[model samples]
Target: MTIPLADDVFRAPGVELFDFPPLWEGAPYWLTKPVVLAVGGALVVCALAWAAFARPTLVPRGMQNAGELVYLFVRDQVARPFLGKDAERWMPLLLSLFCLILLWNFIGVVPGLQFPVNAHIAFPIVFALVAYVIKIYLGIRHQGLAGYFKNLMFPPGLPKLLALTLYAPLELLYTFVTAPFTHAVRLFANMFAGHLLLAFFSAAGFWLLHEQPSLVGAPVGVLSVAVAVAMTAFEMFIQFLQAFLFTLLTAMYIGASLHPEH
Candidate 1:
């Protein structure tokens, strides 16, 4: 959404947080700032990966050092506990997912690129769809078709007769339906709400002082700006956490898919 900057100090700033127009008159229906940011974020990840690993050395330096920290963070925190010895097998996927998501979310705080791509439902849905497909494919490959459904719909923890009648449909519904819905919505919803909140406070800051027409609201405007700045910091931490969680959940889903019976 475009911030309505007041031309005059006494004019009210608009707070339209969810409305955006096409970047250009001739642009395609899907072309918008968020789409550009999503593509840009992906390119940034590729460039960073290339810079880090393009010319490998025995001793890490510059971007490689930073990249290694990120790689190890994902490998240790995201992969090892979930995949165990298979961790290294999937390091490439997990690491890429983590970095891509982190960059996507981190763009929200960047000066010129304040929009988070994941705020657009399409972006998160695409990633979730990929993960969902991978999950089902892995499950079928490892457990066999019938075994996969059996393991999923007929979990062993529940009583046999009760499980057949009660938990079976619930389990199927959760795995087949609710899981992916929540998966995409969680990221999209958070980014959507967060960006709106930041925009609201920022517009309030300008509106109170510029549009108030008196000194009475100046202090409130200052307070609004202060709160906006504070929320931005908190938003950064939340962005990181959300990226980590999305990757972590992806790993968990894949792991369960691969070992459904276990």
Candidate 2:
């Protein structure tokens, strides 16, 4: 009699976890799980905002209190240090962006919806593009087109030859190409890796004891579950951090446009 190995009992999760088919027959290509979750995230954000701010009271309570905390966090930690006096003006955009992303990332760990919207490259790319467009528009409007490019590529007080030969080309490349790519990719990569890690441990726990209930496999299965629980908590923290970072970077870009670095 041949004894089965652990590999036979468990199938390791992979990139396949990120892929989803259409919900129903003849459904459009874009109407997959991730897309639906993305829309749901937006609606959830809107509802939260409405609940928190729809009717003001003499003193904040419940959802309003929660919303106020989130608002203050973004305003103080994200917008003000970067945007300064203009922070309030940009709060609506920055707050919405941060909350939407936080919701999307949290959904990855949700029981039924185990997918992060930003894990899909397209979603992050679209958000990054929005920030990029705003940055360019604000830069051009506040500072003339030539002045914006000058500040971006050639910072003030730099020596002429080195600025032209060394810094200018690199800065131009960073501003136009590298910044936006990294902006989206930073969020995408984090969510992708986190979700993949969670799926792997989850599958390991389920498969080890359930599929092949053996003496040796039982302890390992329990350990796998313990690790999954720990990782889930850690992943939640990471999800929140990634959302903050994405929004912080967006604020930085917008701030840089309005007031170029010296």
Candidate 3:
């Protein structure tokens, strides 16, 4: 379910009286908030790339250092371990996914940008679809269609009956349904829940301060502020964790498809 922000939650006392419009109006066709956010996020990542690597340096500094650190982290921690000898070819894709997701997740923490792009299902869905297509493409490219189906549906050390009754259907479901669903929902749910908690505490604080103008209100506001601060820190950690988890899972899936024997 989509959580609603309180009327005054995102507003400062003397800010202009522009109402927060619904992200969509008609049949959700073109240029929704999430779409705009996603596009903006892509642009931000591209800009970062240009700033970081456009000018090569022997001793990387600033954006270059940050970008290289992220690249090495994803390359060493995610792709290499999973994809083994074939990792170098895929490192760029995984690095791009990691950075994009990290940026999208952290956008909520930026002032005046109150929502994480991944909290919207559409963003995750698009990413998951891309991952799925890559997986299928890799599988088909490496193994012929016959072998791909064999690897997908028929595992080693399984009896023929068991393979037919259990493994085949399970693999089909995972390949066709569960994998993408979980991949998309994992990121979506994390951001959605984190944002909801932040909104709740922030709004609660405001409501307490405004609705109850007594000594009690001050304490409640203070408590709410504390919780908001705590949740912000927690959300920061979660933002990174979700990006790492998504990239790691994608790497693992790619690894499995590329090397099904292992």
Candidate 4:
């Protein structure tokens, strides 16, 4: 439940904030803000990537410089740590994931497009499922179908009896069920909660100052605005962190599939 403000008449924003109507009056049910934002974010990411990396200069400047910074960060912090020699091979996927997700998240704070694409569960689910499918496919292809399951469920050094009775079931659950579920939900939950908090404070400030202005309400309204501002800054950091973590986890999943013993 949302924490109601001190006043009873003023309603704090709730789940309704996330309930976006169709973009057009007679549009299909799926044609909503998040859908549009997700597509738009993807295009923007592509455009930026092209602008930055499509051309090269010995002394990089402008977008290329910034792009290199982001690329190097993903390579060093996310891919290299987990993937080792294979990091470059996976940079394309990892870079796209990080850039697309970071843009989707930053869109939440944009004035007109304040909806984060991943705040909707479906967006994250799609991304997570794609990554999950890739991980599974790579595991089976690289380590043969039976070998993949064997390495996953029965890691070496464990007693056969212990592996069969206890470790196997837990490994199966984590590998097939828990991993993908948490992968999507972690991103969804953070964006959902962050956007909700932002909307709540923003609405509260507006309602107090503009909708129901009063001597007492004005100061509270100002405070609410201050909090919203602070949270917006903090949320940007969280947005970047979430993107990094998501990409990192993707690398880790691929690494585990490629080298199960590690």
Candidate 5:
């Protein structure tokens, strides 16, 4: 016989998923789940690369094939179009960026480790800042300091009068201020919101069935679980898309830095 609690016992999920408790009692609060997951993701990616390329081969076998797929995907889809003939020069950087982010995003969907490293905000911000710094440095290197700013602000095909009056300040603000802000926020917002949605439905299911322990709540619990399952699958797609988008934007930014006139 099951003892039934009030239906109100089944409250919806809170932000607890985002607020992680320290895994060890003595550990600093900052040394939490997300940090562990971040390190784990990095190690996993590195190990995969090592295993795939540990032995030189005339033809790829096993993990090498999968590794090659990832390399080609980034090289052809991401680097080629924007970087053009110089795409090969940047392959290593772009590949690392894409794979690291993809793994971090996919961590949220993994069973027993359902956390997105990028959801923490600071992770994405750091990546955006690093890429932004590299972008500015490359721009200044390719085009002198004054030339870089001038080319960025005064795009070709614009009339000189309009370029000086309206476009210069607007371009300055857009390129310098808004671009990197959006770059960071875009990845952060998606992962944060997606994780929240998953947490809500997952908690709802648990609360509906376990907390209240009622026959009446069972159907709702089942439905919530189903929704959570569907959401996880959808989240995987989103993870891939966001990772791809982030890499694509990085390439675009670097391309812009290289050839500001374009």
Candidate 6:
């Protein structure tokens, strides 16, 4: 009698359920992929920033020109409008955040570098936490702790009972939770979903072409390629939009913290 192996125990060795691995994998202390990407991206941004602004120029050239445009965009469009008189002081920080995030988002779309650093939640969470800290610090610096809390939780002119019931929860949700959570997740979710969808269709096209081995799969693959291109263009727009949105929300939060009455 011939012996048989269990189907579950014996299977094709090379088949994978999905083409890509899960986002995270267990690893030794220093080898985590997300950490590497975060550090690498940060270093690259820093280097670019240094190169861009190392030597001040009367007339900008190359990276300097690009950097100046980005700075003006953030300062004029985002910081100035929201922060007003105080915007000039915060221009550098705001511009850095915008460029860092914009670079990370666009890096995902580059061929051969498929992973978006922001698609991983940790990076965004860290940035959001920083924003939270800055907002709270500025709020307290501008208004003493008691005054800040009052401004936040008990805005003047509202009935005491209504303030307690309505304003408290709203303030708590907006400040302590929703602000950071939404700010971080908005970019993370967009990049994550966009990349996943692109991967799915692109891989499906390849699989169809391989399995069918005929002209039938060719058209489908062509359509998939077209869609992938379209989605890439859309992703570029989203990359810029998300970066700007993140910076804008950050400016708004800072503005609120600085002048909580508004």
TM-score of each: 0.93, 0.95, 0.88, 0.95, 0.92, 0.86
Show where candidate 6 strays beyond 4 Å: 1-30
Model 1 Cα shift for residue 75 (angstroms)? 0.5
Please state the error at residue 228 of candidate 2 in Å: 0.6
Window of ten residues with lowest summed lDDT in model 3:
11-20
Which residue pairs clash within candidate 3? none
lDDT of 2 by residue, 101-176 (tens): 9999999888877788999999999999999999999999999989988887777789989999999999888888
In candidate 5, what residue range of length 10 has the lowest lDDT sum? 1-10
Tens digits of lDDT, candidate 4, 142-180? 999999988988877899999999999998998899999
Query: Which of the numbered candidates is closest to the native, going by highest TM-score?
Result: 2
**What's every prediction's RMSD, in angstroms?**
2.4, 3.6, 4.7, 2.7, 3.5, 6.6
Clashes of 3: 0
Ranking of candidates on lDDT, top first: 4, 2, 5, 1, 3, 6
Which candidate, 2 or 4, would have the higher lDDT against the true structure? 4
Q: Encode model 6's per-residue lDDT on 57-123: one tens digit a residue.
A: 9999999998888888999999988899999999878988998898888877777766677877778
TM-score winner, 5 or 6: 5
lDDT of 6: 0.78
Q: Between 1 and 3, whose TM-score is larger?
A: 1
Question: RMSD (Cα, Å) of candidate 4?
Answer: 2.7
Clashing pairs in 2: none
Model 5 ranges off by over 4 Å: 1-7
Error of 5 at 94 (Å): 0.8
lDDT of 3 by residue, 110-222 (tens): 77876788987878898899999889988988888999998888877888899999889998998989999999999999998888778778766766676544585789787
For model 4, state the Cα shift of residue 261 in Å: 2.1
